[model samples]
Target: MKKNIYLDFAYFIILASTFGAVLVLGAVVAPVVFHTDVITVNLLIDPYNAGIIMGEIFHRFSYWIYFVAIYVIAYEAMAYKMGQRDAIGFASAFVVVCTSLLFSAIYVPKILSMQALGVEATQSDTFENIHIASEIDFKILALALIVLFIRRLLILRVPSK
Candidate 1:
């Protein structure tokens, strides 16, 4: 029972941190960086610079996301072994994590490389397609994190003594 309690606590901490990071990145940082007037108008208008800036932001946050993914998977696996039967939530979250990993490691790098090439590279259709894909992936990850957080919250209740 004590072990279960500790595991639950760990799970909550991991989930909460992951959800918080995703929320901040998606809701706060991305919007402020891309939409707000914080960055110079030239940077905002330049596709190459904009892509590099966004990629850098996500690259930094990706480290935290990777750590969260590992912790969440480990905790969920342990819970499954202990007969918690909540693997589905973990699986969904895993998919989200994997998508995020792909975006950060693979897609973002590609965008950065394209940005490095020149402005013409940024204006290409390939870059546009990848950019769209990245946005879609980000939205999917945000929604998945929200759903997982709500699911975990719903499962938690006070014990009847």
Candidate 2:
């Protein structure tokens, strides 16, 4: 296998693991720490806001931190194999992921704490913007991966010398 192929595979593996953990860890944590009903109740919550049904806001935020850590590792791996332009792209994605994680980890906790203390927390447009940007990066990276896969296969189509 070519070095770049293996690198890409490793990126996929690690990054996928991060995504999987986000979902799985949240599920596991819900019952173990919060409550069995908490998970179900969380479903009704705004996912960010109280929404009259949401569980502890931090419950969701903790998962984001875990997910971001995963992407940071994967981005670091992918950034190595490409040229300058690709490097910039990977860096941009990494920044987006890192920023999202930062907000999710740092701010989410603060919001949850405020809410827990019965202190009114103000909602801002930043949260929505960050979410949007992170999502866009995720889609772009996935699309790029598909394109790279096709390109690699085409490169391999040449008859053995």
Model 2 TM-score, 2 decimals = 0.41
lDDT string for model 1 (1-161, tens) is 33467767777777677767777777777667665456565545444555677778877877877777677677767756755555557766677678768777888788888888988998999999998898788777777777766665555553323
For model 2, what is the alpha-carbon lDDT of residue 47? Answer: 32
- The sequence of per-residue lDDT tens digits that candidate 2 reaches over residues 1-161 is 23455755654565455445444434554334434345565444343344212335345545755565565556455444432124444554455465455545665554445455442333445544543454454444444434443433443344333
Q: lDDT per prediction?
A: 0.72, 0.46
- Report clashes for each candidate as comma-separated counts: 0, 0
Error of 2 at 161 (Å): 17
For model 1, what is the error of residue 141's alpha carbon versus the real structure, in angstroms, after optimal superposition?
1.0
Error of 2 at 91 (Å): 3.0
Q: Residue 99 CA error for candidate 2 (Å)?
A: 1.9
Clash pairs, model 2 backbone: none
How far off is residue 96 in model 2, in Å? Answer: 3.0
